[model samples]
Target: MHELAITQSIVEAVTQRLPDAQVTRVCLVIGKLSGVSVPSVEFCFGPTTEGTALAGAELQVEQTGGRVRCRHCGDEFPCDDLLAVCACGSVELEVIAGQELLIRSVEVRNHV
Candidate 1:
């Protein structure tokens, strides 16, 4: 699955950021409407991190609510649909959340 590739990328990124450090845990902010499945990502984490600095690291995911901004009412509200419309009967909407896949923090141990 693509989650494996994504997890691999995350491990690579963490390693690059802390070349000499050993990753203890990775904190990710995943949006509800981000089109990413939590179980899928978790399933790939272990395999993807194998042989990497974060091999035994813990993967922590935080779920965030999805939001959309209405163009007509200039209001913001929760949105579950990717193409969620505004309550003001406007189809023009800007996604404010639930479409993010970001590493919020990485805990690492000093390389002694």
Candidate 2:
């Protein structure tokens, strides 16, 4: 699954940035429309992070709902999917949220 590759990238990025840090947790923000599977990412996290600074780190995730702004009617509303139509019968929706894949935080311990 692509989540394996994504997980690898996350580990690599974190370790590269904080080579000396003792990482205890990694907080992620995955959007509902991001096309990334949370379960698959969880499965890959351990394997991808093995031997890295992120090894043994907890993977904490926060999910966001999809929101769109109707281009034709200027209406802001919640959208569940790409094909969602606005109440104004407009298909011209500009995605304002819920397409994010972010690393919000990395909790680490100070060197003793």
Candidate 3:
């Protein structure tokens, strides 16, 4: 799965940023429309982080709902599916939210 590679990259980046720091948690924000599998990413996390700074780190995923702005009606509303349309029955829309894939935060332990 692509999540293996993705998880590996995430681990590498966190390790690079923190160096010897021990990562405690990783919070990931995922959009509902992004088509990424949260379970898949979680499955790959442990293996990808093996022996790295992120090893044993808690993986937190926040899923965001899809949102789109209706171009014809000038209304912004929650969109839960790909076939989004405005109340005016116009297919033209501008996405105002969702469709995001990002690492929101990384928590690490403080060295005494």
- Local distance difference test scores for all models: 0.87, 0.90, 0.88
- List of clashing residue pairs for candidate 2: none
Candidate 1 regions exceeding 4 Å error are none
lDDT of 3: 0.88
Off by over 4 Å in 3: none
The weakest ten consecutive residues by lDDT in model 3 span 1-10
Which clashing pairs does model 1 show? none
lDDT assessment of candidate 1: 0.87
The alpha-carbon lDDT assigned to residue 25 of candidate 1 equals: 96
Structure candidate 3, residue pairs in collision:
none
Give TM-scores for every candidate, taking all chains together and pairing residue i with residue i: 0.85, 0.93, 0.87
lDDT of 3 by residue, 1-112 (tens): 7777777888888898889899999999988888778899999998888888888999999999989988888898899787877888999988777888889999999999
Q: What lDDT does candidate 1 reach at residue 105?
A: 99
lDDT of 1 by residue, 27-87 (tens): 9998988888889999999988888889899999998889988878899999878776666
Which of 2 and 3 is ahead in TM-score? 2
